[model samples]
Target chain A: MSLRNALLAMLTSQPMTGYDVYKNFQTSVGYVWHAPDSQIYPELRRMEQDGLIRGETVPWGKRGTKKRYSITEAGVESFQAWLNAPPEYQRERDPVRLRAAYLEWAKPDASAEFFRAHTAYHAGRIEDWEEMIAALRDQSNPTLAKRIEGKSAEEARRITAYKVFAYEGMIARARAEIAWAEKGLELVEELERRV
Target chain B: MSLRNALLAMLTSQPMTGYDVYKNFQTSVGYVWHAPDSQIYPELRRMEQDGLIRGETVPWGKRGTKKRYSITEAGVESFQAWLNAPPEYQRERDPVRLRAAYLEWAKPDASAEFFRAHTAYHAGRIEDWEEMIAALRDQSNPTLAKRIEGKSAEEARRITAYKVFAYEGMIARARAEIAWAEKGLELVEELERRV
Candidate 1:
């Protein structure tokens, strides 16, 4: 359901061929709501069937034709409705936390390695999100540039600010995770000393 | 697969009936790896068939009989393998962050409401996790109490410390979320003032 809304949001910027959508998604919306090409292609077809998006046959490279999809008026209304509705929170299902609780079951070296890997993973995510914030600021991102093309200066600022804000939230989360993993590493060492 | 590991973790504390597993899951492992009774029961059957667990017919109240499951040596080995294995991280698909990125498309009030709800939801989770930590500290949580039964003082301390650390990680995440949403609320107001 959220994937459908994500697709609708992507189409709102401009109509794009399926290939273009797949290409552009990686640099833009995929950071927040990831869907592989497999999922994206099927979802686009479903959105078309549901009348939330309209697909047109368009010229591609040379003799090729491709289907380009644009969000419908209904799509805009649906997106707005979803945006306004109360957010549905999923129950916690964190595998890391589950592992953490039972670190007693793991060898000390394995526990330390687990925390190191956790820190490294989240550190990489922080770097990605920080780069995203930079891209949002300078309007170097093609999808963002397209979205703000005809908008007023204030509107463009609002658009850009929201994206930066969203990415910052992701960065905050990654930072928190990294910090927790560091503490976990220290705990593992302390436990080993006692043993 | 993680669900299977979670169930194995539960059984490691003590053997339990299928009903007992479902009942106790809500308070302990359920917080980390949530599964419905529908999933738990079928997985228990599959695990027994796969020799990860052994089930015995136990007399229940009156003329009823119930299946009680105990983790096999294979189950212990499997759980240890999982705990020591490299963790698998899911790609991001956060609905809140996805919505956050497109706040320009939403009404200001709706945007503010979304942030408020996010804050409130995480605040509630923080409370739940904090209580869990307290329960772990006092050995009042039935599962933890059972797990540490007959263990040495040092063993009990290590067990309690790891569980506390896991819940603390959860609280840290919830705190980060609350802080982010608070900033989001402020951003919404700032944007609306310029309108």
Candidate 2:
């Protein structure tokens, strides 16, 4: 359902070929909602079949044709209904956190190695998110710029604000992970010292 | 696989009836891993058939025998292997965050209502987590108490530390959500004022 809604949201910017949608997904929606190309392709087909989106064959090259998609009136209405619907009950699951809760069962340095990797991983995420934030701020982000391409200045600002706020939330999350892992490293050190 | 391993972890404390496992799941391992009872019972059957856990028919005082499950030697081996394995890539999906990213399409008051609800939700989560931390600290938590029931004082403290650390990570996350949502509320207010 979310993938469907995300696809509808993506089409809100403009008509997109499957390739365009997948490419935009990788850089934008995929950051918040991870879906494989396999998933996206099928969902796009389904949305077109459901009449929430309309598609037409377009020339991809001299030898190929591609299906390009655009939102229908129904699509916009569907998206609005979903937005106003109650948020789904989230099931938070983290393999790292789950493993961390049982680390005492493992060899001592197993934890140190894990936390080090955890910290480094989130450090990279922080960098990615910062780049995204900057891109959105400059209106240089491809998918976002398309979404706001012809809107009134105030409308564009509102659109950009919503996305920046989302990425900023992601940045906060990545920072939190880094902080948690660093604290984990400290706890491991303290435990070793006590023993 | 996480659910299977979590089942194995639960059995590290003691053999339990399926009902007991579900009850404990609500309080303990479920903290880090979320699986409903519907998923648990079938997984329990699979684990038993896989010989990772052994279930035995135990006498019920007056009538039918009940099955209680305990981890087998194979289960311990399986758990250790999983702990040493590389962490799986996690794809985080947050519906609220996803919707937030596109809120410009929504009515101003809709976002205000959403963030207000989001703020209240995290506040409750913070309280729930703080209570969990306190229970662990006092050795009054049933799950932790069971896991450390016969361990040496030093071993017990080490085990407790890992879990307490996990819960603290959760607390940090809840606090971050509160912060994010409060900021969201302010953004909505500013946008509404400008309009």
Candidate 3:
């Protein structure tokens, strides 16, 4: 459902061929709600079938034709409804934390490596999200710029602000994770020293 | 697979009936790797079939017999293999952040309500994690006590420390979420005021 809504949101900016959607999604909404090309193609077909989006065959490179998808009024309504509704929270299913709780089962070096990897993963995410926030702030992001085109100054501000806010939230989380993992590294060293 | 590992971790403490596993899970490893009784029961059966755990018929309440599961040596080796391996990182698919990025599409009041719900939900989780941390600190948690029963002082300390560390990570995340949502509420107010 989130993937469907993410596609709908992408289309709200402009109708795009499936390739365009796949390409642009990596640089935009894909930061928040990741869908690989595998999921994106099938979801586009389903959304077209469901009438949330209308598809038309459009010219591609040379003799090629590709299906371009545009959000219908129904798509806009569905996206709005999802936005207005209370977000459903999933229960905690954190695999890292799960392993953290049982680190006694892991060798000391393995435990240290685990936290280092955790830190490295989130540090990379922070870099991606920071790049996104920069793009949103400058209105340089292609998707965002398109979304804000023809909108009033106030409307554009609102749009850009929320997107920036969302990316900031991601940055904050990634930073927290890095901090926790660093502490985990310290804990691993301390535990090994005691042993 | 995580659920299977979580179950194996639980059985490391002692053999238990499926009912006991379901009950104890809600208070212990379930915090990090949540699974409903529906999934737990079937996974236990599968673990038995796969030789990761051994199940025996035990007398139950006078007239009935129930299957109690114990972790086999194979289970411990599998769990250790998982712990020693680098954790797999899932790409970001945060529904809240996705919705946050599009809050401009929502009504002002609805946006406010969304942030409120976000705050309340994580606030509740913070409370749960805090209580768990307290339990772990005092070795008052039944599962922790059982796990450390025959351990040396240093071994017990490692067991307790890792569990505490895990719960603290959860609390840290919940706090970060609450802070983000509070900022979101302020953003909503500021956005609505300009309108």
Candidate 4:
């Protein structure tokens, strides 16, 4: 989805100033989808002009101007339409993958160093995701927890089961990559000696 | 990384026609990075003017003209610089996340349908990734397997460990999403009943 769509979706939740929207992403939406302040502000402005949303200033007694935004009926309709439409899969362009593609470039002496760096980075990143998986698994968010509470026990269990499986998938992929890098390091070291 | 960078990196591997590059993505890079042919050809034409790469036409009987491209020294150096640079964290702007963000708009009944669709789609995707993980685990690629032959057992094991971890990471994330959707479906249904 475009950043514009994400901004519109956030506004539908509740009216918020551009700053508020930015904060919401950093705190809540940020975990699942990330966008920086740089991208968000420009998109907010553009969306306002497009009639997808409107801005209203709510001035504080002793504060600067804060223009809050809410989705127009038009915006909500557009967002829903966009959601139901077939999703276009964008390429996953990751730096780690690029490094792997260029693995043949590693010189003998640099092989160990490259592998070491990659191993360290992936190791740390995997841990962070694992932690996120754990927190999410708990259904700590009130909206999510309450939703879980409302379901029939069997239904809730089915949903919970899928979530845990997704988390495990991530963990499994991370472990796989780590192993590849480690093996690559060994191969590089051996080639280094021969070359 | 942008599509531009991906094209550049692919050229660094070998001079390839735009068609060849697109095919390469399908076979080798599709798992980690993907771009449609529409994006690739335009990028090649642009990169040519920018001096990042140069293309030469080769005639093939019966087939249309194909322009093969080779990365310039500058392109290679630029790609290397990008490798050493800090990774850019792009948010996963998934349709599932978008739906979650606007869940309030969904009638509990409608929400259940949305969640079911998302859960099924993600579950299938997770399964696909699992197949890939298994294939990689097999390590049947002759070039890569030969490279690994010389490594000490400990080093080989470490590398293997890293690869497995990364694979699990992706699977974990996928499973987590599936779980969320399933639970969300039930919650939506309950909410619908109340309203």
Candidate 5:
């Protein structure tokens, strides 16, 4: 359901070819929500069929045709309804964390390796989030730029600010994960020292 | 696959009926990886079929027969293999964060309400995590006690420490979410003032 809303939300600004939607998803919201093209293409087609969006077979370049999707009024209402709905308990299903829960069964060195990898991974994500924030600030983020193109100055500011806030949340998450991993590494070192 | 390993890990303590597995999953590892009884029951059957576990029909209290499952050598090997495997990127699908990304479409007060509710929700979770950690420290946590039974002092400390580390990571996550939600509230207020 969130995926459907994400697709509709992406089309709120302007009509986009399925390819454009996929590319935008990969670059922008993919950090918050990841969907491969296999899921993205089919979901686009289904949304078109559900009448939440309309697809127009328009000219792609000069010699090709592509079905571009745009949100309908129904889609806007639907997205609003979703946004206003009460939140559900998000089921946690993090595999790395799950593995960490059972790491006592592994060697202490392997446990150290696990946290080292966790630290490095989130460190990379911290960079990704920072880069995204920079992109959003400079109007260099095409996905967001397309979304806010025709809005009033204040409206555009609100739109841009919301996205920036979202990435800031991600940055905080990454930083906390890095800290947790470092603590885990310390725990491993202590265990090895004792064992 | 992780669920299977979790089921196997839970059985490492002693033979547990399917009901026991469900209860343990609800409290202990369930925080890290959620699985409903529907999935749990079927997975248990599959594991028994695969010879990773042996289910014996034992008399429960004086009433009826219940199947209690125990991990075989194969199950132990399989669980260890999963613990040592390389981690994969866990795709994030958080609805609150996704909704936050599109809050510009809502009223400023509505946006503020969203973050406020998020703040409240994770605040409650922070308490839950804190309580769980306290239980772990006091040796009153049954799931952890079972997992560490019949171990040397050093080995038991390692096991207990790993579970604590996992819960600490969860605490870190909840704290980050609270901070993010607070920041989001500030962003909403700032946007409203500017508008």
Candidate 6:
């Protein structure tokens, strides 16, 4: 997702300081998309210049001066138009797989160490995603809950069901990775000891 | 990986016509990387100008002349240096998640239908990857298998294991999506009937 569009979407929901945008990313949108403050703040400035969003620098009670951004008429129109356009294509460059391709270059012991850590990292991510989904389910907003409502007994079980599913897949894959890693480690250790 | 580096590496294995590079993409490299003919041919021309690779016109047995390419010493040095360098960082965009984000704006039924097809597509990919792995396993080349040896057990495992894990993850995730889509479809169908 374009950081600019994400910022505009947040502003349309309500006017927000850049700090507020940062918070939204951490709590909600960050689950699927991420932009560090470095990217966000700069994009915000560019958007202001383009007249897609208007910003006002205001001093708050204690938080000091911060630029509060709101979607301009043009911003909303732009976002709507963007929505009608085709989604950007997805591309993945999995580091683990790439490194795996060149594994023979490394000593067996070192390779084993790498896979163990790699599998563990993905497992952690899956766990974090699950925890986030659980928290979303417990959210108190009626409208949010309604967004998850089902006609029958099956569908109403969760909010962000898609994420939950995706996470489950990730977890399953991680486990498989762990299994493969363990087996590889055993084999490599033997080879290393012999060599 | 930069297509530049990838193309350079391929040339080091042997000289190839632009058509050969294109064919290699479909056969071996597409498993890890992809490039269209449009990108490949233009890049070949660019590399020739840069002196990274040289192209020669070779007459085919039956067909007209083809532009065959071979890596210059500079190209071989460049590719090996790249292999030792850090991998380029990549950002991935998931269109299914993007669609899910805007699900609120979609007809509930329409949203479900989209996921239903999306789930099936992912499921097919997982199955296909599994088949590819099985075929590779049955191949007799020890050099290719040797390519996987010597890494840590986890690393070695990661070589072949990660793909299966990733595939399984996709399947599980797709199933979860299908379940959610079915619920959404049921709800929308009920509403339609009521009207």
RMSD of each: 1.0, 1.6, 1.4, 7.4, 1.9, 7.2
What i-RMS does each candidate reach, in Å? 0.7, 1.4, 0.8, 6.5, 1.6, 5.6
List TM-scores of chain B, every candidate.
Answer: 0.98, 0.94, 0.96, 0.71, 0.93, 0.65
- For A23-117, candidate 2 gives per-residue lDDT tens digits of 88878887888778888898999888999999999887789999989999999999988887655556656677788888877766777888888
lDDT of 3 by residue, A1-195 (tens): 899988888998999988888899899998998888888999899898999999999877899888888999999999999998888988889898999999999999999999999999998998899998999889889998999999999889989999999999998888889889999999999987852
Best model number under DockQ:
1
Candidate 5 segments whose C-alpha is farther than 4 A from its true place: A61-63, B61-63
Score candidate 3 by lDDT: 0.91
Query: What digit string (tens of lDDT, one per residue) describes model 4 on residues A37-85?
Result: 8888888888889899988888867886788888998898888776555
Model 1 stretches astray by more than 4 angstroms = none
Error at B67, model 5, angstroms: 1.1
Pairs clashing within candidate 3: none
By lDDT, the better pick of 3 and 6 is 3
lDDT of 5 by residue, B102-189 (tens): 9877766777888888888878877776787787777788988876778888888877777778888888988999989888888878
Which parts of model 6 are misplaced by more than 4 Å?
A1-5, A42-66, A71-95, A101-106, A137-195, B2-15, B37-95, B98-102, B134-195
lDDT of 1 by residue, B1-195 (tens): 889999999999999988889888899888888889999999999999999999999888999999999999999999999998988999999899999999988989999999999999998888888888889999999999999999999999999999999999999998999999999999999987753
Candidate with top lDDT is: 1
User: What value does the lDDT take at residue B92 in candidate 2?
Assistant: 57
TM-score of 4: 0.60
Query: RMSD of candidate 2 to the true fold?
Result: 1.6
Q: Provide the TM-score for each candidate, comma-separated.
A: 0.98, 0.95, 0.96, 0.60, 0.94, 0.62
Q: CA lDDT of B96 in candidate 3?
A: 91
| lDDT tens digits, residue span A36-143, model 5 | 889999998998888999999988688989898889999898998887766676676767777777787887777888888888888888888888889988989998
Better of 4 and 5 by TM-score: 5
In candidate 3 the C-alpha lDDT for residue B156 amounts to 95
- Models sorted by TM-score, best on top: 1, 3, 2, 5, 6, 4
User: Candidate 4's error at B169, in angstroms?
Assistant: 7.2
Model 2 docking grade: medium
Model 4 agreement with the true structure over B1-195: per-residue lDDT tens digits:
467777876675568898888987764455556789998898889889988898898887788677889999877777666655544544544445555545554445556666777677768767766776665567653322443477776544544444344444456555766766666666556544553
Supply every candidate's count of residue pairs whose N, Cα or C atoms clash at under 3 angstroms.
0, 0, 0, 56, 0, 6
Q: Judging by lDDT, tell me the better candidate of 1 and 2.
A: 1
How far does residue A173 in candidate 4 sit from its true spot (Å)? 9.2
